[model samples]
Target: MHLELAVATDLPALHSLVESAYRGDSARAGWTHEADLLGGQRTDLAALQIMLDDPAQRVLVLRDGDRLDACVALANRGNGTVYVGMVTVAPRLQARGLGRLMLSASEEQAVRLFGATRIEMTVISQRTELIAWYERRGYRLSGERRPFPADDPRFGLPRRDDLEFTVLEKPL
Candidate 1:
């Protein structure tokens, strides 16, 4: 696998990969699917453009040959912390160590580019398996909670009412 910062031309592919990993029937092939709790696009091109335009943010992609297989977004918060999100892996490629590698690369890039002291992320509070995966990688619950954007179609239409985020952090 190869790792690199994603360019504008990669947005569409990245967008599709992310959506396939989180929404729709295609996502059901992977363990990370959130389609059961939400229904709609996982991400849109406009939001991706905004992220690409942010100077403090980096969208990293992991490629197998010429195909984009995984990606994650990292933003330096200017407070010695990097916020990580939108971690996506091709459904068929999930559970093959790609997610772990992509996350590690993102953290390394955060430290290299911004001298980050820690990396933080938010996961759906009810995703026990997902949270455990992060914990195995050294992340710990930070005792913080944020309401899921239920009113935002840009995120997703909540299928269930009990949706919230739990913050997770790891020292870099």
Candidate 2:
């Protein structure tokens, strides 16, 4: 696999890959599915375009030649930290080390390109296994929690009212 910065033309494939990894029945093929907790599209082209237009942000893609297999969004926070979000791996390829490799690539990019000293991300609080996986990679809970955006349809409609995100951080 090779890592590259995603351009605007990659939006459609990126949107589809992320949706398949986390939404609806298709996501059930992988352990990362969030279909039970939320409903609706994982992302849309407009939102992705906004990120692509931002100079402080980069969408890092892992590809096998022209095939986009995984991706993550990195944003330089203007501090010493970079915010990592929207991590996704093709559902069929989950748990096979691709996600880890993508995340590591994001962190490397953070330090090398942004001069970042730390990397941070928010994960759904209910995803214990996912949180543990981050823990194993040196991320620790920072005791911060933010309520899930139930009001935002773009983020998906919550089935339960209890959903929230826990901030996780790691020094680069």
Error of 1 at 117 (Å): 0.2
* Per-candidate local distance difference test: 0.93, 0.91
All candidates' TM-scores? 0.98, 0.97
Off by over 4 Å in 2: none
lDDT of 1 by residue, 117-140 (tens): 999999999899999999999999
Off by over 4 Å in 1: none
Question: Quick one: best lDDT, which candidate?
Answer: 1
Error of 1 at 38 (Å): 0.5
Q: Write candidate 2's Cα lDDT for 6-119 as tens digits.
A: 998888889998899989999999998899899997789998999999988999998888789999999999789999998899989998998899889999999988999999
* Global CA lDDT computed for model 1: 0.93
lDDT of 2 at 80: 91
